[model samples]
Structures are given as C-alpha cells and as structure tokens.
Target: MNQLKVELIVDNRVNRSTLSGNGIRNAVSLQPVLYVGGIPNNNHINLTGSGLNAYGFQGCLSSFIVDGRLLDYQRALVLN
Candidate 1:
C-alpha cells in the first residue's frame, strides 16, 4: 500500500497534472510548465549555482511512460 501515481499532460498552453494514491485521485490545471529548462546556449540557466542543478529535483521513480514507451527506473546507470 505504498504506491503513488502521477500523471502530467501538456496541451496547448495549459498543463494538467493528476496525482492518485491511497485510492484517491486529485487533478489540477496550471499555466506554468511542469518541466522547466534553460535557454539554448545561455549560460544563466542555473545562475544560482553556476550551471549546476541547484534547485533541481531528485526523487525515486519506479517507472514512467514517455511517448507510449515504458521506462524502468533505477539508481545505477550503465553505459554501453
């Protein structure tokens, strides 16, 4: 009983996010994007930390789907 589901759908100018856990579902719509990025070739991306992830997010994601593709999340990364 320790599972949570989060879904974010971006359409046009609005962003809709839904969170469901513990048999309850909640949804919200906002204008700001859920994911933020820096301008291309600009050096002031993370000005607070000098190009570093100073205000980034690090969390545990068991699995996620992108463009109908399912990804199994893990801590360790392998390069081939």
Candidate 2:
C-alpha cells in the first residue's frame, strides 16, 4: 500500500477530548474525528510543524488523516 506523510499544527491548550487516554497512542487525533485510511494497519504517521496561538494558549499538532480530510484539519489548524 502507498503511505502518505501527513503533518499538522494545532493549539496546544485546545482540549483533545476526541483523543485521550489510550486513544492518544497510535492515532491521528483530530478535534472532531480520527481518520484512518489506506491499508488500515498500524502504520506510523508523523506530524511536525510550527505551533498555533489561540487566546492565551499555544497549540501544536502533527498527524495523518485521509487525503481530503486535510481541508477540515487545515481549517482547525489555522482558524483556531
């Protein structure tokens, strides 16, 4: 299967309610959802980039979602 490398940046203080506890591991935890695609095996997805600022908090995030899902992710990443 073809694997894609995904990257993200998010506010650090934004409560990651969707992805907490065990869900934090091996998951590309997005705010409203978690996207898993392609082969659907436990593959490693790396997310790296600068941090974001909202209110008084700094946000940092990086991960992999399906191809089109980036639209929503980018919205959250920028307009926090």
Candidate 3:
C-alpha cells in the first residue's frame, strides 16, 4: 500500500459545533472526518496537525481520531 499525506488547516471563528480540515467542515459532529477513496485500515491512517485558541469539549484530545475513534500514535501534541 502507498502512503497518503493529508494536510489540514482549520481556521475557525465562532464557537459552534463543526469539523474543519484542509478547509472542509461537517457543521454537525464537530470532529474532523477525512474520507479517502478506498477502505483503509485505521492503523495505517496517520494524522498530524495543529490547533490554536482551542479548549477541548472532551478535555483536550491527546490522540487523533479516525471515524470518531482514538488513534494509536507514538506522540500527541498541542501547539499554541
């Protein structure tokens, strides 16, 4: 399998429920949901990004999520 590099830039204003990634928003669930062409294993999916002015509703996400599930990763970061 080949590797896929996904990039996201979420510039959010107004505190409403929405999921913004690479400039896409769901406007409902408020979680980032990325859809690829084929069904890829969650373990194979690698997520990396940054956020600011963010206070988590679930007390800050220590791990990235794929389809609303926590991902297994070596490290997690929150940059201001």
TM-scores vs. true structure, each candidate: 0.28, 0.16, 0.19
- Kindly give the stretch of ten consecutive residues in candidate 1 with the minimal lDDT sum: 25-34
Worst 10 residues of 3 by lDDT: 46-55
Better of 2 and 3 by lDDT: 2
| lDDT at 13, model 2 | 42
Q: lDDT per residue, candidate 1, 21-68, as tens digits? A: 343311111122223232235323223312124354455444545557
**Relative to the unseen true structure, what is the C-alpha lDDT of residue 16 in candidate 1, on a scale of 0 to 100?**
43
Which runs of model 2 end up more than 4 angstroms from their true locations?
A: 12-80
List model 3 lDDT by residue over 1-80, tens digit each.
22223333234323333233442322122344432232235523222332222222333334454455675544332320
User: Among these predicted structures, which one has the highest lDDT?
Assistant: 2
Candidate 2 minimal-lDDT segment of 10 residues: 48-57
lDDT of residue 28 for candidate 1? 16
- Stretches off by above 4 angstroms in model 1 are 1-54, 74-76
By descending TM-score, how would the candidates be arranged? 1, 3, 2
For each candidate in turn, give its C-alpha RMSD to the true structure in angstroms. Answer: 15.1, 14.0, 14.3
- Model 2 lDDT per residue over 8-34, tens place: 334434332322333334444354544
